[model samples]
Target: MENSASNNILDFLIHLDPFDQLPRDIVATLASTASVKYLAKGESISFHAFCEQRYLYIIRKGAIEQRTPLNKLRARLGEEDQFGFTFLAPLRDSEDGYRAEAIDDTLLYLIPHEHILDLCEQHPELHDYFAATAKTRLDSAVRSIVKKEDKGLFFRSVGEVASENIAVAKHTDSIMTVAATMCGKQKSSCAVIVTQGEVVGLVTDRDMTQQVVAKGIDIHLPVHHVMTTNPILINSEDKVIQAISLMLQYNIRCLPVVSDHKVVGLLTTTHLVHNHRTQSLFLIEKIKYANSISALAALREEKQVIFQALVESGVSAEIHGQVMSMIMDAFTRRIIQLTEELLGPPPCEYAWMVAGSHARNEVHMLSDQDSGLVLDDNASEDDRVYFAQFATRVCNGLAAIGYPLCSGKYMAATPKWNQKVSRWKDYYSKWVASPEYNKLLSISVFMEVRSVYGKSELVDNLQEHLHQTITASPRFLSALTRDAIETSPPLGIFNSLVLEKGGQNSNTLNIKKFALNLIIDLARIYCLSAGGSLTGTEERFQYAVKHGTLSQASCDNIIGAYRFITQVRFKHQLNALTQGNEANNNIRPDEFSSFERKHLKEAFKIISELQDVAKLKFVQGP
Candidate 1:
């Protein structure tokens, strides 16, 4: 074997699937036994049960569109995807024939059939990966990725870990009685308030001190008056991840676990802290009590560790992002608190709002600051000055912890973003009215704003106003749709490179820019066009489907693509972190396993198909 060709082949094989699961020496040996082949566009390779020579064809570059004997399209292959599984079986068990035509100028690595058989024999674990069925192979590949990840943290039901030591009292019970009950022999931190055998509210130990002792409230008053009404509750059968997400979303220490509308137990931060995997709950508690910026900054490493745990927990991307965003929100809220201690109280009412991914609860390790301030409309000039300084400190505090400052300067620190409520509404009205003014970028980033701290109604009002503005303007959706489809996903991978349309190729793929953002942008357009106010990407798609703007099948397909792509991005970043490099979105083409490449090609096609659907529905439709 030629040294250069062997080295190149080994490099490519080392990162591809089933091969990746095998030993390096074995892969190198197989690479040495492989031959290279090229096919021009429209060229076809005809297969039959018996052939003069047989080889497992792994696509090295360009596209191969497989077709049945009748000329119906089968599967399209791209770089890193293999297509010779059916003929790999021993002659006694061989399957029928098919034709593989080059959809583009193509390069392929042909490993002698004997080499694949010999390797699979030595590594029985890879049997399914190279089976005749594509679905089985893909399933095997996905399972391999989760083999080592701890599935318990994400899969365990709430009832498994929740403490059954909850204190329950009637709505008519006096505060003193419920408070005493909480601290009595049961020694629970919270009590569930019920009425007519129906759980109605919740009150925590801290509530006793702040709402009763500090305020000098009459302890004899009904617990309902002091209890948090309609408190967040979790079902006993729900996954622990859902419980964690709820705790983070509502910023509560305990959740009443109800079975059949009856309070059964309590799931508290204390219960979760006992499980090493749920350290996020413990981390949040630490953030709430940190007295200074330095104290809060020291916990940055812990945040990353929890992120690592979350990814390793094998949770879905939506849950992963929700957990991460909750951490971000905790940091942001605490930083504001400490800043206030340093600079006196805020002069007037204001909401510290987060935008983009943060607002959508889809933040990842790569997320940056997309934030702003919404002041009460009555805020004076002096109040504006005060809030501006306040914004700077909070932004700087976030940067110190981990989140990078937005390169586009969309943070609260930017003067334009720190505005009175009316001005903010006016900004949306003007943006929607003048889509021709090229306001898409600004609007796209801030369009998903949600208040993380202070008056949430401010952000809610703005979201409603945004939906109304989008609904009233006929040109806005058309313009937004046009902008949304401007960037098409890559035309699949080239040799050790990503090939976008227009003959451009790069060694590293911008997974966020080319793939993820395109889906995100489309979701935004669909949801907003349907007069929906949902923010998260998955939920927005669900909103579109529920509102009759998107089909349920499309919603499920796109959301599946979104999850797969997100998982790959996170895995890439995780791999980088483990290797001591800074995590990023730029993924090297060769870093993909054969399994990932196969699925990614499908995912890319899904995005491309959805983009076409958007063009016809929003751009070309009424």
Candidate 2:
């Protein structure tokens, strides 16, 4: 029985890819160090503690109950079930280790800690997997258990609390009279212009100023002449965020809120701005006022508050992504400007490129700095030196302004990432033309690149050329689609949550990589394949819809998946930031209510479905 149990443990370790990378001697050492153990029902394996050393414990028979802080919930582990060492291998506090309690009489092999340490010391890559897996598990746990405010944060439907005493004007009313009523009564920006109490036209200060005052139209002109016809309006039951988006998209200050085709109320920029419950006004202000390094740095520090407020206010995930992106862009540009000031002007024409999250404009509270540069084709050695110096300074300055340097140095200073436009085009052509492993990765990275400063045309030209290159190469798109499919959300059979094996977050979800990135990657591949330049995931979906590449229902599903995943991530980060914890994408299950847990599970299910469809569509057989 003992020898059979030992073989089972060895089989389990063999199944884990990490062991396959080890030398035979190391594997033998691990096998010798390991001990087969048996636990009866109610046995406490972890004692609510992480294994001091990395322990690969695999259940040979019976079951192990993984207990949550909330006593009512327990995850059952059956045959071949493994749980241990979530954070023990160079563990960070961010990760959670497993705590195992036996559910039935169970047999297990406790792999020796010394062997684990020795193997990790020999193979840093193996150690890294442990750390990454730990982090991923921790992030997942945070997602599963984190608490969100019960009240609809930002976009609570405006049906009840919304002011229904809306003033309306006829399209024939004089512009001056309408303006007088608005200014005189200190009323919200616009009144619903109704024809027999049915919304026909809406007038606001922006419309009045742009159409009447700016155009020097007579004030005595009828409101019908000045009022915006076919104005963007919202349902009274709609979220205030929907109203805000309508306003921002059209540059309108007010929108008529109609119900059952009857004017019920008016939603104004002022109402949204003043009503603390309506939106994250401070976040908008921060993004608006952040024009310099100091301001940006200040905003970065206050990002937590802004994020929390925004999530609580019910800001739509799409708008939230954009707002965060815009603010990060502002900060990044300011850092680049400050760096330029410190280093003086470059010797030649060059464009600073925002790489990664900033490039995609999907920055979160703890977004890292991912950027590079591109010089003109005809640059001298002296010019290259200057560009390099400027990029180094810019990266350093950015590090100071909250964007930490990437460990891999995927920055402007790196020659691989920074090059002349001609060189960049050559690289793109080589990648698409051949599509090797390194080249495919390069293209994937390039998908997120955008111009932050300097010659935007260079970056724009590169984008156009890359679009042509990718469109010309079907293999490149297929490879990208395969890459995208690799890190899918871990929604298990029966649509249950698949928790990480070992770590502080042993049973959590990685919302960013698994959830958010799935949508992001899908959008990216589809957009690039379709010759679309839209960056934001939601925007890409919309673009696809507009171009007839995807159905409206498909677009809605993608958008819904994105929103559900992002909202949870944002809320998790908000909680961490508020609690003085570093902002991260991992979430624990205990932090969530049962209802939220069900919702999160459903969201991941949607993501998984989308991924399967995308994979089927994009990836071809060998």
- TM-score winner: 1
- Single out the weakest 10-residue window by summed lDDT for candidate 1: 494-503
Per-model TM-score, in order, reads: 0.79, 0.59
State the C-alpha lDDT per candidate: 0.84, 0.66
What TM-score does candidate 2 reach? 0.59
Model 1 spans with C-alpha error above 4 angstroms = 1-41, 44-76, 79-100, 103-144, 168-187, 193-196, 203-229, 436-438, 620-622
lDDT of 1 by residue, 78-166 (tens): 76778777788766666578899998999999999887778878988878767764444544544556654467766788988889888
RMSD of 1: 6.7
Q: What clash count goes with each model?
A: 1, 35
lDDT of 2 by residue, 78-147 (tens): 5554455543444444243335777678888777656666777888655643442323332333333333
